[model samples]
Target: MMNNFSLLLLSLVTVTGVSATWPSDWGFGGWGFGAWAGRLSPSQERQDEVHDVEILKAVVTSMAEWERSRRDTTRVKRADGSVCYSNVGCFMGSAPFSYLGVLPAPPAEVGTSFHFFSPREPHRARSLSFEEIVVPAADALQDAVVVGPEFVPLQQDQPQQQSVRGRRDNAASDDRSTTTTSSDVAKSTTPSSTISSSSSTEQVVPSSDGSISLTASSLDGSGLLEAALNLGFNASLPTKVIVHGFGSKCSLIWVHEMKSALMAVEDCNVICVDWEPGASLPNYVKAAANTRLVGKQVALLLRKLRTQYGLDPRNVHLIGFSLGAHVAGFAGAETPGLSRITGLDPAGPLFEAQEAEARLDASDAGFVDVIHSNGANLIMGGLGSRQPMGDVDFYPNGGAEQKGCSNLLLGAVSDISFLWSSSEDDLRSLCNHRRAYKFFTDSVSPRCPFPAFPCESYEQFLEGECFNCGSQRQCGNMGYYSDRSPARGPLYLITRDNEPFCAHQFFLRVENTPSPAEPLATHGRFEVILASKELNESFVLTDKDDEVMETGDSLYRLVVAHPLMEELTSAQLVYTAYSGWISSGLSSWTVDKISVTDAFGKSMSFCKKGMILSSGVPLLVPLFPGDCNPPRAPGGLDIAMGPSISINNELPSNASGEELSASNVNRTASPAPERPTENRNKTGIDINISLHLVTTAPTSV
Candidate 1:
């Protein structure tokens, strides 16, 4: 008579097509599935126990080492050995329960360089030694739901396992012919892992408590339709499918944060795609390949939703991060009329330089927007693509080095601060890749608009040459509400280093010389003050430490809040030069022209286009001199503008540059001493300044 144990082994071997017998000296050779039969010899059992114990110890030790190195205050080691540190989940267990749960290993042809989770059947009897059990590689496991104290992918190798996985595979291939025939592009189903019994796709519907529910196990078209209706998914509302990146689960903090923000704005159906079965860690290449299969499954789900309900394909939006970004692109390619797709710093390592069909591109949807926050070298751990992959690509803060990620001192403080809520990966790092999604989440319902200006490059943006938005170079907003429908090409913007990443933007053009003569070089800081009917504001502008400017015509942009003004009044600017670094090595500054603009789309020309104003004694020159009056342009020290000014020889040249000194240049003396006889050889320098308005009112407000 066939007993339950024998029957179970036979059933496993039959379903997975894996033989029941494997070498007992598995550790000495390599890992493989084997039959569990009669009791083992005492020596053999002892060896198995020792090997299992050592593996468990190694896993646990690695987890501890990682946690200690991170030193994140939020880290907590659960009783079950799982560690939730740095907001990234880490599952650890003894002998059978591995970090990511049991998953079928990749094919033997791919080499045995991969490490896998403990077992797919974690709920099996613990008394039965792992050596006495049949365990398949991760690529062979199937099923999508198995709720328990700790969550892991479902087990589908059993005889009673449903055919959902098989149907999902077929749906991926079948829907392609019906959906993508018009483009004449062959629809290739995403390559799935051969080890698993089925695919690694799961469907999530937003629940009433602002949480999401795993409603569907497989990608079966019919099953998806049933689950969609049961979950109260409204097909009338715009559908947003949020896909996660490699080694990430659907319940990640950023994923939930995005879901909450999206649902709060409107009554829409937010379907978060959960494919953790293929998104496991320690094997990034496997996860990369799984994106395609998972993406096809998503297309299948969308197709079912459209056919079963009166859903419009044009209203669907796909947003993906890292590898998930490419997944979204694949989905867009399969389904053709997706309204929009947003790539949050799409992964660059393997996807870069790949063909259009192999990665995200503008053709993937009606309007595609991408945010590149970490586009540095691969050797530096940068994971974002540098190539423009969307209709509107934003390179905030130059799109390579991010703000707030550095601050060696702050990082040390945060390591001790129990309230460390930000991801540890972002702390004390300049180019953290995850900021793409963080910026997007805040922009969904931000207090201030994240305005992006169309610029030639990040370098030009810093120089403030690309602010004019009308005919020359049109600008646009970035993030969820960006006007990508009409916006084209890569856009550049700047952001603050802390929370509330938005910053006020202004573009200024400085005319440094009036003639073609050799331009003067000067180093100093300047401040702009505005007087209006309602408010008074001041902004300071300075070159970066390494940004020395040679006297010449130049355009620059400033990101700072300006005083609110319905109508133009008057503006004034004050420039103080560093004692030893001024043009001609003199203690004075020369100005030729000036222009001004505010964040509220207001523009005002300070002086006549080519007018020259010099200061022997540093004094404020009213830009809109005619507009300065009683209630219109309020209080400011009136200083006369002239082509030249005289300075006193008695006053020392080492005056503090922090403020303009009234005594050094003799403000009361109309004409004092002439330039030093030796200094007469140097010519005066001219500076032109223009401010271009950049920020726009938030769409929601």
Candidate 2:
């Protein structure tokens, strides 16, 4: 049965005669069933087979109709007085196809001149010869089919001219027969430049002339509305417009998840913008160029919503991911007083170096918040921009390579098995690039507040230096509530690797105090395990680099605890000495105390004076609270709190000599030290621990 299904897919590809190269990173070994046959159950396999067949049939019919439209001889005059055979011909003469080839001269009666503003040079208008534009018959098959969760075309041995009458007839009889050709649909929706379809199940159609489609769906799963003044739209509610990036459509799983999340959080109008025809794969440069036109369409829609329906522009929030981010920016630029725009890892390739007017910037809206999840250089496999493009930028875990995306093999496997997974987000590939929307969706109705601190750099933030959000730098929420934050500039925070990435953060400081007999500077690592009734998690304060810890040195780390621990019951300390040839004997170190500060400004100190820790041993210590208040001397003078001392022989500056008696000396309670035990549990720490630590004092006071 699996072999027959694979053969059927291959035959369909052969019959369609649509041959094109797919992206190398798509991880397509071959059109064989071996990759997924064993992973999916019988029922899932049957459903996938049926779905694949339907998609292939639709692709064949759509391609056939597009070809017919491309070959049509009827000339239509555009509003700009340019004559073109069809909508596809008009698009062929546009700037996106500039690199294709020159067109032949036209007749004296026909106008062949086509003018379009170049994306690279927006200030200048260039005229191109479009007397008779001819797209290569073989290369004209540019549309990609959705196979499972990925957008890829079927592999074929060679391009062959074959009839698609059977597929077209089958598609016409199906319930999805309303799906029309790209050019046909573009003509029908040209007046408003928006397509109205069911947001729940909109078929992605190829578009030309950079035309945009809008699908307005409410929480009740109502069908698409024609305009903002339609009965389906409620002017009283806030509006959230979601735009997808290049090589993606509005009906994508992530787009659906985001729309659902936003609607679930509040009663709002969710408008999903679909520009797949202009933003399809194989021509990233063309898609980048089309963003400007799509942005204009979105801006026009917002204007109608404001003027016709009395919807305030301040209540409109545009959320765009990747290249779509810039689309929202363009719209925001046109529509003044637009409330906010949230860019999720805006595209980096063409627009990263472009001017602010051409890309997403803070000036585009009243407030712009950007989440940069994969902002590394393009040469390093990053697809998102690293530059700050908003009023408040968020760089979660440095915004480059995200957690749980380090293993290339794992990501590839996830992509291949996407169909079998229960949740599409869990098995999606390009983990870092796609994480921006996931984070934003999770933040809509979060389990806890996703607080991010305004810091100069993520490295400094990890050292517990930027714990306080003050007048200089205010704290910002990572997701839905970021616009309400007073924070300006780049904010940094750490999250878990998986879902519910938000974690309770705490600043932890451990002071190392050694005895006179022991070495002043010991070389080892310290691991702190915080245990609560809800969860037990461990975090390392130092790396395995044989770090030297002097007697007075302190280690600071940002502890991110998940499962929402209300109160920490106890903590376990594990010390491992660096095994060197000269120091092969049993090594030991003494710790004074551990201090923890929560996000709410509450501080707790756990003290056990002269607690000895040996190599390869774990010490389970109970949570013993210690008073951090300064003690008063016998003469009622305050004693300055300093490092813990074994003996206090000095007197207060204003105290008399007679008052310096032993009974009059200030004393503080110290918890009894616990002995190290030889337990070999070797439990691994949670994914929240970043493994980077700061040993020196923070530069900022």
Candidate 3:
């Protein structure tokens, strides 16, 4: 005479072998399974409620628009150069395909190609240098589909959503193996607290003339992060992805399971994360160089998540497998607001060779966990068979007992997991280290990994091997292993959240004022910029503008292709002031003129947020990873700080309005006075962002 609840619990214990002590820090101290089972604090409670509310708000749509943002190659030539074979349906038999549509023409091979939506700007597609490449045999190709909302990675999503406030036991692991259902999660740990402020110490990603979109935020964090998520949710999807990570050389079976898991979730946005090599088409580069460059790129991407996209820093997490683990961990370390770091048996030599700051560890990353697959780690020796994989000293599982196929022929997206259950078999699951990752605290299900073993409480799960040592497929072996693949939905791409720092790298607040007739309400943070610079001989500025620049006119322009480009509401003249002018301190009101035809030039209204931008008061912030010499925090922001003008004698004009009259700004008296004995230019304007924000009203077209 057993009841449904008892029977269900019995099933859970029998199938998963979980302990009674589940859901530790999730505020559910040994409580049963239920949304309201946990006893969370006000903050935790509020966060939980907010997530649930968002879960309700999210509605799915076709993300066909976003697909255009990335380059797609339906087919590529095989090295054997035989036929144009496609990777469609079940693995088509391997036929030597010489050419594919995914790659561009020969011109694209030599010329640098630029991506409008990318913050990386003016990128040369990995390289289309047109040479011999890994020939794809028809059988080698696999049908690729984007995962929908159901596939978002919670381990990494927590940070993007601002929830990585404790040990970052991100359930990130390189566990995809022979089985279709197997997948692994990395365990991470961290103290409880969210980090939203940007650091003044970190260097901004240098501004680029190439098409680059930036993401910047401040105070409590808001901006593109919110907009993008909203946009993602609005797209054709069942759900919007909050975050995701990337791995390498995964199996087809793994991909199937991952898609299934994602399909299980409703209205979820899947944020797909991959390495540089996964840039649509395959272009090989030196493993060492690619690794380092990927790290920097990851940091820059984080800036975009914050300033351009509006993702909160504390919600950011890292999930990677093999070399991907190195990339994710290194990038997380470089980012200022990172919360969690999960290493799925990080490529040993590739990661371990670096200094502690650059490696994935508790000390370096606020929260970090590692899942050794016996697949590869220093414990055994030598980098995984995959190219660019590091030496064994770094990853412990360098030798025998490894399971994952050691082929360097898979996309990072292929490694997502379907069933994120607790079972540390082969040391892949149930390992004490793996069990404690930050995500474990949020046990969605109440039972522990060793349910069948009959552990009465959580303390036993922790103290005994039963809790930390069960695998999805195997009950014994110690290598990390994934028992299931992530179910489908959207392509879960995980980027960082909003960060106050690195505005230069990405767009922050913009003050776009198009036409005086347009209400200030139409003015928003993200507006297309129009420069008034008269294009002349070398695309440089000329004193007169009677003639438009010719095809050869040296008009080197920068375009931001990001959807969040409209967030830059505060506009500033981007010009190098004339050095010989009598108005030494004041820069001419010059800029790259934009036209109404611009994508962002359309009329749009927006709301302004309060910023401590000029708080000029400095505060202590964490240093980015690889801090050979971390920058010191300022005691306070110095609001009194002003731009460096050529002339120290006369103060610039301080105007109350957002703009200066064209007549006043269009002065041609540049040659009138010399620097030493020039006019008494005392118009007195202090170029302090703080003052301008308070005094000037919002402007827009």
Q: Model 1: C-alpha RMSD to truth? A: 21.6
User: What TM-score does prediction 2 earn?
Assistant: 0.58
- TM-score list, all predictions: 0.53, 0.58, 0.26
Candidate 3 lDDT over 1-701, as tens digits, reads: 22542343233211111111112233222222111223333333222122211111110001121233223533533221111111101111111101111211121122111111111111111111001011122232222322221221222211221112222233322542221111111111111112224332322231242211222221113333333432232223322111111212211112112222222222223232333233111222123224333443444445544554555656554555445565565456545556555454454433444444334544434545444432333222223222212211111112222222232211211222211221112112112111111112211221111011113332342233222112221121111111111111101111111111001111112222222243221100112222221210111123332212221112322222211222222222222222332322122121112211111112111111111111112111111111011111154211111111223522223311122233222222111101111122112211111111212222221
Model 3 spans with C-alpha error above 4 angstroms? 1-230, 233-269, 276-285, 375-701
Give candidate 2's total backbone clashes. Answer: 1
Candidate 3 whole-model C-alpha lDDT, 0 to 1: 0.25
Stretches > 4 Å off in candidate 2: 1-231, 407-429, 470-473, 514-519, 578-586, 622-701
Clashes in each model (backbone N, CA, C under 3 Å)?
26, 1, 185
Alpha-carbon local distance difference test for all models: 0.47, 0.53, 0.25
Please report how far candidate 3 places residue 358 from its true position, in Å.
Answer: 4.0
Candidates ranked by TM-score, best first? 2, 1, 3
What shift in Å separates residue 662 of candidate 3 from its native position after superposition? 96
Q: What residue runs in model 1 are displaced by over 4 Å at the alpha carbon?
A: 1-187, 190-230, 407-431, 453-455, 483-485, 509-523, 529-540, 544-555, 558-574, 579-593, 598-602, 608-701
Winner on lDDT (2 vs 3):
2
Over 468-504, each residue of candidate 2 has an lDDT whose tens digit, in order, gives: 5534446788877787677788989887676556666
Residues 352-405 of candidate 1 have per-residue lDDT tens digits of 776676678888888889999988644343557888999889898888768766
